[model samples]
Target chain A: MTSVLKLMGMKSMNSKAAKTPLIPYLFWILLFVIAPIALILYYSLLDLNGNFTLANYAKFFTPIYLKMTFSSFWYAFLITLFTLIFAYPTAYLLTKTKHKKLWLMLIIIPSWINLLLKTYAFIGIFGLYGPINALIEVFGFNPKQILFTDFSFVFVAVYIFIPFMIIPIFNSLDKMNPSLVFAARDLGASAWTTFRRVVFPLTIDGVKAGIQVTFIPALSLFMITRLIAGNQVITLGTAIEQQFLVSQNWGMGSTIAVFLIVFMALTMLVTKQNSKGGRA
Target chain B: MRDLLQATVAIVIVCGLLFVAAGQMQSKGSTGSKDTLTVFNWGEFIDTDLIKKFEQETGINVIYETFDSNEAMLTKVQQGGSAYDIAVPSEYTVESMREDNLLIPLDHTLIPNLKNINDDFLNLPFDPNNEFSIPYFWGTVGIVYNPNLIEDHLTFETWDDLWDESLKRKVFLVDGSREVIGMGLNTIGESLNVKDDKVLRQATDKLMTLSPNVKAIIGDEITPLMINNEAAVALTWAGQAADMMAENEELNYAVPEEGSNLFFDNMVIPKTSKNIEGAHKFINFMLDQENAAQNADYVGYSTPNEAAWDIMDPEVIADERFYPSHELREKLEVYENLGLTWLGKYNEYFLEFKMNLN
Candidate 1:
């Protein structure tokens, strides 16, 4: 009886030890992530009149704001899709290469530079007097107005975000079980089938991670959009910025910010659900 | 397998946590340095050489920063806990700052070159007797256009040209409420600082009509837009207009017959500044005739100081964009503060107008 009691006590002590690690985990989540989000939510409810009001949220539902929000998402979606298409081949090649580290560095070195600098570099490459236009003019084409357009904005955004997608896809590809490919091939599956059925499924998490990284930042970015698109194409980010800077309507700005946060959260939830389903 | 999956999740979570911690630490570290003077001014408005010169002369390092709009400058300054030593705010902001007690009064004796500023710019409505601020630069807001692109020999004589249907998606306006709304008000024979709600509404309605023609609403680097031929016309300040004209002779700056708003960006010692003496020294040095001429030449803006103008290059002084005709000067109106009560209304209507643009 004493031995059995001792065994039970040891089991309880082991369980307590196992649970102790959760304290640091909870502390990190609560401190780093939860606090600022809570503050943002709090700030969102306050109105421009210095009174707590739901009017900001009501204002957000107006057709104009809704349209702006829709456009923001649409642009972000296009950026993500383009990034995925561009990144896939590069990621696959990087993973298949023997000198993976060097190739990875080549892919990611641009990201190490300041985002603003990279955007400005594109201005030099794609602006009206930029090299591309100069080259086109030399080829007997009229100088194209490439800068300050929606197309330029998307092009710059995709270029900046491509690495974000590539890195994650490369990571998942790196960790992928090589045997799965061989197993499918041995079963008389073609190379396309092996990739489609085996490699793609295993790397869905990376794709989802890449999408989250690219899409969210693209949505929040006002600088690149403003610089490349020249305020012709207004996004929710720019609108929020205008509310804060030009209007000085902190209440309205906070409201728009909260709405964005909610929309982002909803997207994250959907993606998480999709990721879980993919895992299953 | 479950344990391994849990471990991988744990590692990912830890990495994310570290990233957040590092970001927070870096931000905090960049801030909270007591000796640094965080100055927020208009982009390319100041001579960075002057700041470096000030640091070398006084040994008080300035952490210079810039903003494109007075509203943006105000928003950050209002956040209030940061130690910004000096800010180059426009005339109206100087008024607002004085009323809010956000500015520290200048000790005129400390700024010896206060004598160098033209007497006309000193005793303005924003700060009568130059108590709270020192004038940095002054100019009028007007229209800039490429002569090559305009079909007609359109002299751009009036603000009404902005509303012309032919200019749709070819015109660019400054993304500024005061400038745009003031232009609208002037076109309709109202004061730029109209406090009357009906007059403001009229202006707003008029401006909304011009929205179809507006390709972009921008603040800085408007020169590139005109130079690149992306825009046929732009509403801009004298400095940007002069810069564009310098790059391309086809560009011309014009003040509307309806009149335009005159603005002065002044350097004020903020209440939060620790180095008031250093700030004063910096202001005086900047006001020195040679320094002022260099600044004016570099920024492509007109100087209010006759002494500085005399020292400026004959070519720059002769540039019509920088030096408007006496008749045109007579027609320009300086912006006046509308006080706190009317400011709220101004903000409200501006918000509504911007929302309607969408």
Candidate 2:
């Protein structure tokens, strides 16, 4: 970052040669990010016959799609909420722990395993004959079906999202100036009051970042619903997958995606406050 | 600062060269004079050993590609820039492809062993007189239960039998719109392909009521769950049921006496087939009774080849539960290609039923 600023301050920053480094980044944005989105937008305007039509968008506005979207948002909200609830504490605790980096690495290592493998592991763990049920059996209760329940669905999604939610929060909390905490205590502020005002407000950017990573993926990363919820849940991600893969309705899928992107943009706008103030 | 910029430029240049090199390699693939027969089948659906055998004997390089669903397969075939010598699509998909002129009619002269296919499978409504597709394997959607886990396993004789109050939260339905809704339609004494929205709505309502018995509508995970006695009763394809039954001595499959979907996955030469002769040879090799029997056993699907049955294990051929008799086959309904609108409605109703579950 300092080098970037240093480059900006240099006279060469204004010259054509200085722009060379930005080319690769710009190319990446154009090819991988912008191009695919543009294609999806184009596909959204086409009907089954490849004829130009706004009917897909019109259909998306209907009660069925809207209700699905609402429920998907509700699920994503629950997942994000649960993730934050668990993650904020873990991240804070880790910041105070000895060898915090090692602890953070340990937390992240499980996430490095293939997502499908992790989801598959949960199937065994939550199965009717699985450990949870076995435990229930040992406790003099009848074994219960746990794999397909809403509780399992939300639990697995929250589990998957915790690491993502933690890293950003851990970064921001770790970066906080500790003297402000001491200063707050010196001023006779209660610990709770100090945390609320002095700690949390200063690390709002990290919380926002945490929400950005967890909430957005939670909205779309719904394959776990299929594996864990047993296809009882129809998340927007599942709907999109069904349309594109099962129904072969690219137009409808793209329409849903376009709305998702729009909503995600709105989410970012709402969550992200004035960055200049947030950093301060 | 200069070192960093130079490093970034060098990395970018290397990436650009790599992409160009990859493109060249890709473009070079089409130029090969080597005899390559590309077969697009369901992912892990076929016996890989048979592919190696065909390649070894026929001297044609077997390039196997796969798709998860018929719709996804249809999209690839419809997209049409690339050529696949053979494709295995379900019965309804074959109908759609035939209508869309996506498949080329087979040359019987090259596929001489095609005669081994059972008469029961051929000249069906979908591809009359074996016009485009050869029945690769046929199976029915049925209830498979672990007898040890349930008291009255025989009570699962019909689709309606699944709703028994005794089987509370013990059922796992296959996670497919058609199969689940078809079970609903069949339970109400309607055809699996019932199109009328009114009747469809009835099936949807009926299925929704079975929420008590339905533990989960899961997919391939059903095999592991059922084998380990996780759930007592599961609605699954005969092939998958065979897999579970093979693994667990306690498991048994029954095609509900009332009705069920008899799905056929057939091999067809797509219009874009570059090696038509090679495709025919591959098909003929697979159609050989020994090969067909071997594949049927390995892949856990019912061989449509009648000749293969004589060569198969006597015990297997005797399993009326897995491969039903003529009377049972008559009762088994084959799903038709309900055009986009109706298919979409089927999925919608299924999705609605799913949404109402929570």
Candidate 3:
């Protein structure tokens, strides 16, 4: 990434001092990115009162934390799956449209409004007296409570994650040459076969990118769980927030965060291999 | 699926904003002129008009910030990203701040109106002889229920009644580890400061039994839930219960006959403050007989200012249940500052209880 950035900088600047532009990015990496992670690691080894201790790490390995980790991963997997299932088709369809960029822009407009407002909107939309329940009651059935449930939790998460999933898939689909599909058809391949063997294989990178973006945040989602799920879900993010802010156990929060970091790295590693394997 | 693209754009925007906020915080450590006083208190705990009035009268610029909880407030002050002159924290937080040397002793000369405060609220266990803190407001943790929603056969008065079947999936707990776990302890007759896991486990197990009745555990949103009748019963503070009752006249608050928490919010000067003189002025301004009474009327919690009672809302003053008489207060518990270890344990159990909500 640095080499690519340097090459781009050298081309843009048309000078030997291309290295100057790299300084700010290097500083940002060192200060904002690297420093915070280093702090988390350092803090993880200390107890509540700043005394050195490894109890936090041991606590993370306990059954309770282990169970929470498992549940968090399960929810993240479900959210990623649903987001991809929904976003992939929409992105593919968008690429086929005449005003694809305008349509994409229009779709992206709602996300500009505050996320909290959007989340609260879902509260009313799924409320007992809300439109969904009203629709149900229209069918002559009683309105059911829909605000605080696992379904609402996943639904809201997928809603929030959809755009992240769609953009990458859309980009990849747009990049593909339309002649590939025609070539596959010329070989007597069915439409489904063309997509499966040619189009889908090419777009695997975008899908993997979508999964990468969706799953990591889904694992750490704390606020959505509290507001929509009514605290029924305990993501690792929620636990970390509880430990840090409520319990004042920075050590424990940082230890959990370190684990989250590891999990994120593992996820990145898993998603990254597909692109490499496809390229070769 | 189009929503997916919109959300991605939103995420990018939010990340950019977060970076900007971080940058601002780094450059925000310096306090403004002495005329500026930064006051940090709980969300919606103070009257805004009074803030404007104070600013006008004192010729001091009031920079007001609100925190959702005591822990969050303490963390902000401790982190020192911004300077806060005065903070309104609950009893135990004031106590902990004192222990941590995070507070400066109050100057009584600057706050002569402290003489108007009730004797009972003056010097509590948290701060000896009223040195480090001054009572801002005091209230109880109680069950606020709507009688119209309760089944004809169902009755509730004490903390145990929260477990009643008729209230199933209707109870909303205040989102506090100490408050929720303390209510569980109150049922089993354990102190709020349970030092050991054995009693805590008992409280946790009992709370699990009450899980069927718990609809949600929340913060500021709990009030709306109660007002909308979405939650038929809520475990909330006296002031918030009062707010809910005002909005929905049918709601009734009951401090369970079993011992309940008597939370006292106090004004403390954290070490992060650069404007101690301005802070003292603000505190005194808040404590003035007329100002205190007006605040009491607006904020709706039981006032610590004895002088405020004479001119405050007659009905509120008469409601002995909300503002407990001296004898009733004898049974009310003030939350003790359980050091980090025990506090962490309480939080752990409460997290478990929350995770078991569904």
Candidate 4:
């Protein structure tokens, strides 16, 4: 692609006098990314008539919406916490297992399916007449309603997002120098101590990266919450979709989007500082 | 230097091909022709064969596009560049579109087959006088219940049964603002279009009463549950209920005595349409009895074409889920576009209700 572009009178980057290759990317970012965000910010600050106003944000900060914001954060935090507990050990075992590549591939295979499809598959399995309920019934228990409940909501969220958490942790774990554990062991550290002090510290970067990816998306989760939790779960993403689609409140939708961007930025900053502290 | 010229020519050719491909994709009708009619509608709502047949018969190439929602369709048409010759929007959306003057007054002279529409479906408050739109497919918002499961709990007669505490966790409400809240309004004997704040509050409270019993607020996902007998009762559209009832013997549908939402999707020519004649041709073609019946059967939605009744199967005509009896028909109210302010209020209450669930 670069060769094709270069041949079409685009300046080659090899020459010292050549313009920075970042120019095209900068233009793209300006047009698609920055401009849309700028437009959203502009919309956020306006009423429906295109007049300047901050009432959109004020409307968003009402007690109900505030509750929605806190609930979104809480759900995201829980998803992040659950994914960390479930994925860290699984990723660690993945590194130890024979055919690690195959096992890693197997772990990632489900994510290759569409997110909607994955949620639907879980819905079928979690429904009252589903296989799990069928098995429970065979053993004499009444079939349970797993779906449209908090448990299934979090379960499906974790299922869809575990790969995102695992991949980053796996990358950091794989990159860890195995000799650090040996060094800690030779210094009379027990297996648990070695893991806690050396191995855990080493994987902190991956864990931070993992949390950054998983937690951010979880904050804005819409489809899974609706499908698995049956509109019983309302995250910020659902609110944004409703505003734009159902309510036709472009101003309010843009206002919520702007807040989400701030939330994501604050989260990234917190993780970035924590990782720096961990390394220190 | 020679290779550079050759490479530049290759790049130009590739760019030209991409430009051409994009142009073709955007234009529903073949390039720059008066013989093309562009149509926008819901995805899979129309059978492709019908479009092909229309194209073949008129030699007017059809450019077909689809939208998932009426809001998205309005947004596209409002943006003013796509130039769709026709769009099919739901009942409430047609009102908004007409009010905004986004649609053109149809020349009934061009579409004489407008007579095919059932008198009951005509002169709807949304497009009264049949000026801007023609009825496409119509259905009612009603209850689809499993007789086997609810035999002992409660009799399903009035909208009040949906709120029965004895059937807690066995009911599924359709995931829409208008349908769910409209049921509440109906149960309280208020008009479905009640915009009074006091009435709206009462309706919200009534909805809250049923909140504990709702297993899920769902859309198309209710179909599988209804068919599989996982849900005892689901408030769903007539089309969906009819389809599910066909598969599940024990399942029955009811248009409660209090009243329910009877909605229709209408075909309209947008103000920006470039092929008015072709648009009329397409609408007229679709209204033909045989064609209307074929499209209805294919799409599994009820048709408003009275002529279609002649060609349709007796079983479909007898299916009360799709065709309500005269008494039930009197109790059914067509959904009105509650305008923007009321729409926002409804959305707020609906969101609050959903949030209160957990």
Candidate 5:
């Protein structure tokens, strides 16, 4: 009986040991995420007239603000799709290579440079009188005006964010067992079938990670769009910046920020649910 | 094990978020005392030599910060946290700041160089009798265009030329609501600070028509666009006009025949200022003839100080862009402060206009 009691005590001690580390994790969430979000929610309910009102949120529903919010989401969605399409193949190829480290270094080098500097570099390369136009002129074509367009905005956005997509996909692809692909092929599956059946399923986690990384940034990217697109293309980021800077409407800015946080939370929830289902 | 890793990742992300929040809170807590003087002004607007001169003349060390726009400068000061010792607000903003009680009344005794200012800049509507602000640099807004880009000798006779189909995707304007809307108002022979809702709407609509032709709405500097020959014509300040013309001889500046907006950037003490003596000394040093001329040369803005104008090279004064003729001056109207109600209306229209540009 004493031995059995001792065994029970040991089991209890082990359980306590497992639970203690979670205290710091819960403490962090309470201190950081929950606190600021609570503050933002409180601030969002304030009115421009300095009274506590729901008018800020009401104002957000106006056609102009609604359009801006929708456009921001739509643009971010397009950027993620394009990033995945281009990055997946590159990342897959990198995983297959003997020189994987070299390829990974090349993918990451651009990210080491400042984002603003990279955006400005693209302006030098693609501006109306830039090298691209100069080259076109050399080829006897009229110089094209590509700068300050939506096309250029997306192009720059994708270029800057491609590595984000690649790193995760590459990580997952690298971790997958090489035997799985070979087994599928040995069962008379073609190369395409082997990839679709064996390889793609394993990389869903990476794809999910890539989407989260690329989408969040693209949603809030202000400077690149502002500098490259010249503020002609409006987003929730610029709108919030304007509220604070130009409008001096802190209440409105806070409201927009609160909405953005909620949208991000909703996206994470959906992503988490989808990932749990183990389906793309 | 999976749960442990998940918790660890969650903890890491939470820590990062906490760090950012803590940093923001710490910065707010550490905003310095009233004894420290913070001077907020435009980029390259003041002479650092003059600031150093002020510090030497008066034992007060001035903390100088800068913004690129009058709107940005006013917004920060209006928010009232990092109260500035002094701010260089443009004429219209002086009116706005005064309306908001953001400015402190100036003691004329502190600025003895008030005698050196051109009579034309004194007794303005923003601060009549120069009670609250002193004129720093004054100039008219107009067009700077490259002659080589156009087939004909294109004279910027009116703001109408900005909308010409021939100049589509070749025209650039300053990305400022007040400047852009003022241009439209000037074209229609209306005051820049028009109070009538009907008149303001007309100006907004007229501006919308030219939106498609606009290649870019640039900020204070258009040197990159003009230097690269990306834009053929730009609505620019006289200082930027002079700088652009200096770079390319083919570039020229002209005051439109319809009218132009006259602006005077003035130095004023904010209500929150601590080191008033240092601010005064800085203003005095800037007003000194040699110092003023040096600053004018550096920033490329036309100086309002008669003493500074006298010291400038004859050719510089003769440059039509730097010094407009009496006839052109007659066509220019000083920007008056639109009261709070009108200014609010202006902000609304401006926001709508910017939003619709997409």
Candidate 6:
């Protein structure tokens, strides 16, 4: 192993104590992550004139914007739920099936396309003279309006976010020990009992990770909400876009963005606590 | 020590190249013969061929960028130190830019072709006396409807036609606060920029009545909706109406007699322009008869260049969507810069209208 390390020309480190390799990482985190959040927080607490005030937060908490915030949360929740439902079976089957890597690649291929492109492609599919309407005609039924509807919004959200859920869940499932399931079965547990008691518990980490990946972005989707939802449904994402772009109110936009960050952090905290409790 | 020496050598080489490049750029600037002109305009608003021709004719390099909206362009300029030599902003945005002193006064001596502009197109409220702006393309907000679909209601003579009960679930309103609210105000015979709170509320209430009829609030998507027979009526720009009319003969556009927004998009030099002479040359080249005609033909938007009218297609000239009649022009109101507070109120009403959709 040392020879292989030497062959790669990686100098051998002391076994008892290796040097810290976090300086570059710390620099990047400070610059990109810490600084941007600090800026957003600063902007959120200030008015347009740079006076420190909570007026922006007050505006955000108004009846209309408050409702938009809750609606965004609900949309995210729905998207996460649907994505998980569809992703779990697909991911589980991926682990158990042949050429798992190929299947995983296929699942990830659509996500490699730009999000705006995917949204626009869906726009074509759900358009007035789209294939669905043609299919309806084939079945001798009246065509339905699918584009710009709430269902299409959620549908596109689930489609776009499913891969995010699947990748994390697939990783955890692939890393699971078969012996645990065997042990559960050997202990007079039925197949259902084995999965319920062993498999589900083991995959909890993946589920948490999947929820984080899908829910956070779903909460802040603006383009898809506008394009697919036809701007009929307003989300916090829409509110932020309008505030910054249309109303020219940076304070309100930043306030909503900061609140979204906090909401996401809270979700992460809850999931972290639950995972820790499960491990304990 | 060897690695350090090598790194030092690399830095020295890079520095040498950068210094040479900087010196060359400096010389180019000092000579007052810089070839590059940076232009920022609305996306797909200009004919690319015209830019190429101008580059060839003047032996100048053109660096062009396109913005999707006036707000985005304004924001970029307001961020300070914009590198754009020229930007095309809408009329209302021109007013805002003038108020902020973001634009420089145009040199008429540099642009002799300015005489080609129609009398009607110049000396308006925004940048009056043609001080800071040169008119590029001017259009109006109008209704595009299918004659076959609306056979019974043949005349969509006013903005009130959009509120027709028969058109419920078949109407598409453009997703703009000013155009929508202004149409409502125009229907009620009030000023487009109505300042009174009660009048604004009344217009807002009037708008709410048409909400049930609106199938969707969309921007550019309204064209395809009408083309595909999804919508019988749409409130759209004259440019879109002309484009869609060419596609489907059944489509017709009408600038309501009650009045609508007569918008002008003008080419202006920014205050921070480094290539002011190049900007003037480009503007003059665009105002030339052949160039103006080509631009109008390619973009499908109406041209204000009087000399270009004779060169344009008779079919295009005959289309009222491209050029309104004198009576229709009389009724039209150019958009004014509503102050920030009123703009906020407009946005508030728009949001409220959207919220009530649910």
Per-candidate interface C-alpha RMSD? 5.9, 2.8, 10.3, 4.0, 4.8, 4.4
Question: In candidate 4 chain B, what residue range of length 10 has the lowest lDDT sum?
Answer: B25-34
Candidate 2 error regions (>4 Å): A1-28, A278-280, B1-28, B151-154
Candidate that scores best on DockQ: 2
Instruction: Give candidate 3's error at residue B87 in angstroms.
Output: 0.9
* Candidate achieving higher lDDT, 1 or 4: 4
DockQ metric, candidate 1:
0.19
Residue-wise lDDT of candidate 4 within A1-280, one digit each (tens)? 2232343244244443644534554455677866887899888887766689899989998986898999999989999999999999999999998998899999999888988777888888998889999999999999998999978988888877899999989988998888988999999999999988888887888898999999999999998878889888889899999888887888889999989988887787677635353343
Candidate 2, true inter-chain contacts retained:
0.56
Fnat values, candidates in order: 0.30, 0.56, 0.64, 0.56, 0.38, 0.43
Alpha-carbon TM-score of each model against the true structure: 0.82, 0.91, 0.91, 0.90, 0.86, 0.90
Give candidate 5's TM-score. 0.86
lDDT values for all models: 0.78, 0.86, 0.87, 0.84, 0.79, 0.83
Tens-place lDDT digits, model 3, residues B1-358: 4555565566678789999988776555453447788899988889899999999988989899999888999999888777888999999999889988999999898999999998999878899998989999999998888989887544455777888887878888888998899998999998877798999999999999999888877788888878878778888999999999989998988888788999899998899887788899999999988999999888888898999888887888889768888999988899999988889999989988877776
Better of 2 and 5 by TM-score: 2
RMSD vs true structure, all candidates? 7.7, 4.5, 6.5, 5.5, 7.2, 6.2
**Any residue pairs clashing in model 5, and if so which?**
B157-B257
List candidate 5 stretches off by more than 4 Å. Answer: A1-32, A273-278, B1-37, B52-62, B78-83, B325-330, B336-348, B355-358
lDDT of 1 by residue, B1-358 (tens): 5665686588788889999997885565345433456677888787788778767867767888888888778777777655677899989889988888889888888888878888777898889998998888888899999878876857778788778888867787776767778888988989988889899999888888886777666667577768877688999888888888889888888888888888889999877666666677778888888889888888887887678988888877776666776676777888877754466566655545554553
Question: Compared with the true structure, what per-residue lDDT tens digits does model 2 show for residues A68-172?
Answer: 899888888999999999999999999999999999999999999999999999999987678888899999999776888888999998998899999999999
The clash number for model 6 is: 0
Model 6 clashing residue pairs (backbone):
none
Q: Residue B216 in model 2: shift from native, Å?
A: 1.3
Q: What is the TM-score of chain A alone in each candidate?
A: 0.87, 0.90, 0.90, 0.90, 0.89, 0.88
The lDDT leader among the candidates is 3
Q: Tens digits of per-residue lDDT for model 2 on B1-358?
A: 6765787778788989999987775564455515887889987688899999888897888888988779888988888756788999999999999999999999888888988988888999999998898999999999899877777645578677788888888898887889999988988899888889999999999999998888888878888888888889999999999989889988888887888899999999998787787888888999999899999988888888999999899899888987888888998889999988788778878878887776
